[model samples]
Target: MTEQNENGDFFLKYRNETLFNDKNSIVQCLKYFDKDNDQSLDLNEFEQLLKSLFSHNGNSYQIEMAKIKAMFDFFDSNKDGKIQLIELENFWFKIIKPTLFPKNALLIVDVQNDFITGTLSLTNCPSKHNGAEIVPIINNLIDTVPFETIAYSIDWHPADHSSFIENVNNRKLAENSPIKENIKTFDSVIYEAYPNVLQILWPAHCIQGTNGAKLHADLKQVDAKTDSLGRSVIYVYKGCLSDIDSYSAFFDNCRLNETSLHNDLKKLGITDLYICGIAADVCVAYTSMDALGLNYRVIYIQDGVRGVDSDNIKKQEINLVNNGALLIKSKDVYDMVGCKDRRPELAYATFLSLARSNKV
Candidate 1:
């Protein structure tokens, strides 16, 4: 390689290392990157400073420089070539302190194929809300939303699960001579899943090892790629037992057992939860309510969920609203996070726009 190319490669490599540094405390970072004793950072020093503050994995030099320039311009109030101590302080206060991206989590509930186009498809459901539609919206959210943790719940059930009406009818037939070929969906029956527990049967769905049990092909997991900003991807499996149903991601249908979801969120120190996914009236609603019961703030993305029953969906909305769940659309999420752009002025302006929007 030529001398000029080699010089460029060295600077790029140095920049990459600084960008991915896990060092805590802005003061320590400033001292380490500041090669000179001067308290102020010149364009080169400022570039290094900003890069260290944010994560940049394998970004091209041109792109990284462009982003650095935008951020420098945002903090450089006097347009002086150097960013002084005051500017550095302002950067920390405005950009870093206000947006602690890792305190929030995105929870997606039951976006499996069974809820979409499988035998128990929500499309064939009473509301006829296409569960597949949520895949793209949620995939987009997974990319754009700056959440610390991302969690998904899948309904994985045993073949002879008690919630299945087929199982119930068979049990009844064994007791009596015969019965109707099958009961309609949503019809209740007193079947003995437990000694005295009356189980409300549902259409057989999400059996383990079945196509219906898998998450949708289009649904993008937060950490599908190494470059994904999503810190962790947690999968919570529910309704796996043959004798019980599980609607809430955190607990079984009878609240007899709890999933690892609660402990995971607690371990991550998550304070706010943003939820979306299939069957808004059932799984989504149940999970949101459970989150509320745990004293965590909850926001339900209305456009990102479909429902099995239209009337039950309306009722669930009323119940959720009454019990303190913020109902919002997908577009409002940008404002909630105050924009992922590193430019402080633009981020503040976007936040102000949402403040005036009167939707929050």
Candidate 2:
């Protein structure tokens, strides 16, 4: 910030209020989000930026926002239903240190209903895992972290499509065509390309207005429609492609037309990303790997994560540590955010155009 001394000498001091000790991460996180040119970073811009960091196909504007109520539960440390700079910076320091927040801090992964319900789970073909442990941990984490911004990914599908078995059934009966459902009974099984369909077939779920598509009971909305604290949250839609699956919220995994989640994160000056969710071996794994690839420090909490156990979660954790990522637990998160936030301010341009009416 620009200031003058008693001798009328002007000089520069703190430029960014979002300052942290880490040169690679926290310090970089402050480079863009300090909006007021003040000497201390606040929560206003920080929270907003975290919500809208990912935009795939620029259609994020059309995404469903009903699931973002948890964002406020994380960022509003005071439990007063409102977030100010004081409330935000305080919790941030608490997470980085330990013994800083009024309580503890945490981050959550996908807890939506479509993935948790037995009928809605992607692996519906006889699987013991139902995304239960991951759901409760996410719920509990939200309560612990103050000023925590929540990012949820919803898998939306178009009304009429070849992705669903029902849709395929309808087409078979029409136009004097008969494509049987069973293996031997089929006249001809159309070899369609669906990267999401693993070798097995399961009932279609998350078809827009369907109940299975909503957030799970354990992951219920904070206050019906709005966030529990009445704060705004950002919603991102993934796996919109009828031809493929997008397990990772960061990208579609096809790597064809990627969104700027990294850039949005950089703009918000987020140094550390904590990831957890259902299908720890799939979506959660893919997202954590991608985040580290972008040079972001990450902590993957085992308690906050669940998986189909197809690939052994333990082995996956080892892979993460090998790639500059940390495999932590729910309890460890509290120590990480216990006391490591420093509030600095950045100087930026604020143009003001004033208009006055007077009679001369």
Candidate 3:
């Protein structure tokens, strides 16, 4: 069982603490994970060690296998594919203790079935956005990356919501002669709630409790039950207000009202956010912008996101990088995270473009 201090804070017990704080523990753990009993650990061996360490004593933190592999690469400074015993010892004291012990959150935006394969499927979307392709990537991340908090931003809308083209078409059909005037999908309509606000009507999707609103089968679900450390996955429903559309996880499009996400993160003491999900040009872009505005250092996982419009997405990427969001490939997450300076290395042209762009 885990141990607790006098103040009721949970921590590693004396025996466990000594094991982690010393080099012998590293050597022992390495041997246990090393299936061949070799002094060096391969990718599979390294991954098993990570899973064991994090899940030890019912800690219940989910970590991605890829990040574990990345961690291994960082330790294998000799550029060898396998991690030597001495390399494992160096990692425990120099990297792992300082970098990953802090509080962090992983924010996944709109990985629902609707965005993947439902009416609003990005596969054949206007920009031919293949949103479904991100599922396996994200699932892998969920399985391997360890974070204090896991939050999901779901686009839940009522059937009569103003953003639906069907509702707009129905209203228009009633007021106009069908033969003379017909409203089609993707029609733009102005709602009186926010006058002059252009509401790009989408196919009705993610209605409250519908199957379309559910998360994709491949995505891992955090248990509703909190672990011993008081950690569990959080679900934040946005775009529920009938009149307005909410793209950012923190607030509506107009910023009229905010979601519980900001307060929740604040309470959790989350200083950094790792963001990934579907529709990069829209939801992911907006969420990254808001996170930067909120003073939270944002890291955009490039491989873990898909775009609805390729052109728009390229522009959005430039804009996000300019606005202080660090762009990184998913593989770089483990190594890059070990440093206090999180600025990503960029080419001259990329930096210049980012410096000039103001909007996503």
Candidate 4:
């Protein structure tokens, strides 16, 4: 039989072995699977337990023996070839619970010196919002919440970056470019290049190794390594290529190149991304949109973000909400992260993720 058929047969046989009634506690469920009544589950019994967990509401997850073996070994913490009630309890709380809920990450996007007070300061932008105002708000969240992962994205552009107004003459403008002659900052222009790109012109800022490229001094800088709380800190640098501009921390504007943010978050099993930062209409909006596209539950912290254009920020908020992102305030984050304020929208995101993986 083919592997698929074999897995299907296995599911058919075990789908009805155990029913997960709402009243059944973990201990009770373990006893139900312990057919031998030895207060422990052998590999076969453990497989049935996992099968039951994944099979629910007219869906049966395809079981892979190798994956099952690995999980079995992990939960068999003592390596006794069998999982005791205690080991099963650990599995229930640590693995199963989080799977049903979600693992969260805080993504702080491009809150740098240049955007706050240097050359490209938002105070000079259309909205004239103080970018520095978000620093303390983000810092408070960092200090209070025990997020599983925290990522900070920076605009690490090169001196001759195409998005910079000074370099507008370096590249040939596309024939279809809306504005070619007398190009000015904040004007949208199309470049004549492979996969012709449309770019917004900005003053030269965030040049590599420059002081403006540095994150704001007061912004909390968590070490880019695993901490004692098992939390991971990551720094994502975008717009490094002199040719292309990158707004989303995950991918370049043209989607030609990808930053390590996606793979890094995947490695940590990040399910939900709580995004907050500068330029809500630009980088922050792009990052949040990309996060939603990647199947993450996105929560946009409204007050924790500052934007360059107030009108565009409002439009971005509407767009994000229409695309399954939750618009929330910083005040509501604590309860949400602790899973005390379980929003149905977030739960729906979790369900959609499981459904896409064919695990529902």
Candidate 5:
């Protein structure tokens, strides 16, 4: 078999020989890679270890010799030419374990009643897709996928939120605003108060404590404090400030203010994010983009999202893919999470992260 086709076999062999073997500890594994039996890993032995860890799913992974040397030097503390058992253990726990078994999270964004069947219903938008159609699809993922963390983002807007069309008169319109009179919903206007704050106006919806702000009744809500499965549940409330609008769960549109989502996921050591929810071109797209920016492996569930505009959604999908976001189906998530159906794209993403960290 070619080197590419041998990747799966190599991984299985490595798992059986090193990871699953009860007799082989971290020190033993390091010694096994020490071809000369010198009790420590030399530069050549170290390169072999990194190659095996990086190559997965029939991908012919490659790295410059200079980078491999840098990695070896990094692990070889005290300016030692060889990697000892102590150094190998640190590398195994910090890098190898995370690469092999990543912590995954399912991020459900803005699946509220208002976007589904109320004032800001997507059915009335250009695409006219039923926003409620995604609820069952997302619920199935929640029930089946064994994700380490589940996060639900809510658009918790105040009654006088600036994005509301009715509240247009509340803020002074910027001089650059195109339409000043007879302001309508879906109109993009720049507000003078925030200094060039361009916002898309929508009907009054998702006000705090209102039925519109609540998640759809059919949607499954996991309690963060008491999850039966011991999974971490997080609720991220965005657009809470009346003056600024937050499309991404992590940060506001201007990126001036941040929510608790990034730190929450970081606290749990989440490495991958499977994002799906309403308005694919808006909230879902923004969240996915931000997740990518935050160095999270983003897998977007294609069928589990509904958008306001078909053209905009297509454009956003292309943009996401160009920026390293993986577009996947809901069905593929189970295997991907379980590591049964490994993807080269995700593997490459992980490699890129390690390479960029300058530690390897």
Candidate 6:
């Protein structure tokens, strides 16, 4: 590395000056901040990391940008265009630790197969582990809501899904983790399996035949029986868009999306929605909030949903309550809509208490 100082003295030296007071921390921090495929950082990228650590009041994306920028300035001492791998070990890694640890926030973003099983996720999703308890609650909720229809966000990939390992052509064309790889996100990936430059995407995980790709077995039986599903029940599937990440049944994240649920609910004269699903902190929480925002009376069954982390659960629960979506345990609902003759396992009087509560 060579550079001309402010005094116009030209000197060439190594970047190992402050890489470490301790060697282990240097190696770890360098590995953490280096996200892009390239080994070097630019000024903009270096600031992104720095801003995140110091600036406590910003969104995740904002913090990410700042962190990226900070890396750029710290390593590119000579004003060079690119940073070498060794330069990262010298100066940048030292200050990067306090920057990388995430600040805790309370919000439910989604609970899905991709998240529950680490097959296709980078977050510490809490709901996946609690699947055992959450599933039965969902089953009970489904049974109780006899008149209402259900909308599902299933990732029904084509036989040759662009995201699958089976599609060798896609694997070759796409980078390991392309920014817009899925057909749902970028419509171009669907028809032409082989693209010019697919981004570096996660390794092939959720392709069709893979066990990690299938929906929960319980949801599958119900999904399979959709045609046989009660006439009163309606099902809408989202996330079928090859390039998009469809979290909500109503719309894909990237596109202006809509579903029949709203119109169908209006048809049935139902203004209230009992929203519950996997990963209470994520998709289930997001959908309920959107429902309340849309002026639908939203009721999120607490016992019926699960989150990936304690922090996610705490955040999502608060969001649900603030949005005017009533949060209740599963037993609470079973008691409310439950028939007088057909009682839940609980005592009859307990049922009345929930049924008569404000949630209804």
Candidate No. with top TM-score: 5
C-alpha positional error of residue 17 in candidate 6 after TM-score superposition, expressed in Å: 81
TM-score of each: 0.63, 0.53, 0.63, 0.72, 0.78, 0.45
Winning model by lDDT: 5
> 52-146 in candidate 5: lDDT tens per residue?
55554544346568767766777687667999888887676655655567789999999999999999999999999898899999999988888
Q: Please give, for residues 242-344, the per-residue lDDT of candidate 3 as tens digits.
A: 8788889999988989999999998988766889997898899999999977867688998889878888888999998877677878875554443322231
* Cα lDDT, model 1, residue 315: 93
User: Lowest lDDT 10-mer window, candidate 4?
Assistant: 1-10
lDDT of 1 by residue, 289-312 (tens): 999778666778999889988899
Of 2 and 4, the candidate ahead on TM-score is 4
Q: Give me the runs in candidate 6 sitting further than 4 Å from their true place.
A: 1-128, 144-147, 157-213, 219-231, 338-360
Candidate 3, residue 288: Cα displacement in angstroms equals: 1.0
Q: Which residue pairs does candidate 1 place in steric collision?
A: none
Steric clash count of candidate 2: 28
259-338, model 6: which lDDT tens digit per residue? 55556556755544666665566557657766655555565777666555668778878877755566666665542332
How high is the lDDT of residue 85 in model 6? Answer: 52
Decoy 6 TM-score against native: 0.45
2 versus 3: better TM-score goes to: 3
After superposition on all CA atoms, how large is the RMSD of candidate 5? 5.0
